[model samples]
Target: MLVTPVDNSEIVAALDAALDGGPAVLPLSADDPRAGELRVAMAPDEPTLPGTAVVVATSGSTGAPKGVELSAAALTASATATHARLGGQGQWLLTLPAHHIAGVQVIVRSLLAGTPPVLRGGQTFATAVASMTGPRRYTSLVPTQLLRLLDDPVGLEALCSLDAVLLGGAATPAPLLDGARAAGVRVSTTYGMSETAGGCVYDGKPLDGVRARLADGVIELSGPVLASGYRRDPGGTAAAFVDGWFRTTDLGLLAADGTLSVLGRADFMINTGGVKVAPAAVEAVLVAQPGVAEVCVVDLPDEEWGQLVAAAVVPVDPARPPSVAALRAAVRARLGGPATPKLVRFTDALPLQGPGKVNRKGVKDMLRGT
Candidate 1:
């Protein structure tokens, strides 16, 4: 069957119907060019996912669009497990776009809990909260949105009143996480992706049935919540999933107690002078500096060292920004010389690709161009 794309309110309704055992739906941004690409990928074909409920597109920031096929059972399992982990099912607020897995899952979870999601629309968090009927309510957001909310007293207070705030879509900076918790926000930093139906791991621990393991430092996931496979790409699906386990590109460490600490993506490691450096680890150290508000660390081509670590920084105060020399000293003290950035360029903001994820590839080009 041909796939019809939907967005905004229609997506919520479509997802509700799908959760109630309707035909599969592939969501796409109303204005995004990838909608055509995704529709083509989901075109009528042999061996299609029988009970597939949603086909979500990957970030598409790197230029190609690929759909992750999610079966109804997988999507519902994720919703059930999330509700169990979060203490109970509650009304949800859809702040993210339905074209993304995060947004689609929000609709599924709300419907499964017998409540319609309250879309953020053009209203404040406080106003959104006022519209909610359930005493137990929750909202999902990315780290950047959480950072912005921290500056709004009313919004911060509104978030504080919620049962829990699920923060995901990207890594949360140490300062951001600490600040939110310090401000009385019940924030759970999530880990997982479109492949795992949004977040399978919450706050470094796997949810009810999701299993996280390490294959030579890379994270591998398995359980009922995993996606069926990629749509129209048998090769990609086979490469990512094998024997009921999905091989993740992210590198992680599973503590003896079963807590997983993600060590950034294996492809994200920057090689400088025969040494490998994890950008997340380096950013964690730099972000703690006084004036740095946000930072993105990437590798730049260097004739001398082959590849040099470079950073694009967004300062708390542009006029009184931390000097590159000072930033280097801070990293050198904590992460050693190889991990220290060779070049530091301060900027007003970091470019973003997907929901709250820092566009590292864009940052690298910006730093390298100058």
Candidate 2:
């Protein structure tokens, strides 16, 4: 299908429709003549960048869209990296929506694997897995999708059939990954964003031709998969790529074994009495408590402490809000003095934006009556 820029959205929708057992119309854009092929427009006067494929979107968590100029080489580099990491691609099962880089990578990797993936149309994970027609199969899922799969035994068994499953999009709660691994699922955690044309790190290690490093606590990446800067935004491009490295806002540490362990975003760190505390760390501990279903830790303004650690949690049972004291005690057991949350407020359900991620700004506003 020759998909013009105007038909990009239609192609994405049609792709999903095809996967869901609906009509498979090869969506073509006004400018393009064929199906399944997309041709994005460029200003005739402006010099085209090195890449053929240009993805325009912000990293969803940050809420700012910038055009990422990518070359076919860069995208192919990412796909090749993924193929090498996954021991050559098996039959891929599509679950995520098209248009996103991760979803796009699935299609490309399937092509690179010399076999089109089995399109599991509009079905749940179990239904999707049951529909595949290959020996060794693989799929990609976000943390939330993985959690939903874990909620049922049948779903768990279905996931176990996959030779490998790439888990990305957001942090995978350790407990959730542990449960999946215990239940016989090969879950490999990945890290990357749209700027890198999807994930470059797989299972804490950078794929071949990918570079992962930390500078001043900010996670930085380089090598083949990095986008050729933002489109028509010199300032944004310059800021995103400095000295040939894309410095991510995420802070992380390189373990002794050379694995990168992300430590949440640097801006999200809460300072209490001049001590820095990681909200993700706090929430990770809180959510492990017996009665907690979900938790979001935010920094609340405090004249004395500058910013106090406050948490808004969703309990498993409304009538069983964990006591503030008990919650504090639980957090303290894992984290020392400054890491404990000063305030614990229970909510019916934590405000969510995008699957599995609690909307920090929205949660703060909900607390402030904004």
lDDT values for all models: 0.88, 0.73
Superposed by TM-score, candidate 2 places the C-alpha of residue 341 at a distance from the truth, in angstroms, of 1.7
Q: On residues 212-266, what C-alpha lDDT tens digit does candidate 2 reach at each position? A: 8888989999988888886667898899899879998999999888899888999
Clashes by residue pair, model 1: none
After best superposition, candidate 2 residue 263: deviation in angstroms?
0.4
Per-residue C-alpha lDDT of model 1 across residues 220-274, encoded as one tens digit per residue: 9999999989888889999999999999999999999999999898998988999
Off by over 4 Å in 1: 44-47
- Taking all chains together, each candidate's TM-score versus the true structure is 0.97, 0.83
lDDT over C-alpha atoms for residue 297 of model 2: 88
Question: For every candidate structure, what is the RMSD over all alpha carbons to the true structure, in angstroms?
Answer: 1.4, 6.1
Candidate 2 ranges with C-alpha deviation above 4 Å: 1-48, 118-121, 317-321
**Candidate 2 TM-score versus the reference:** 0.83
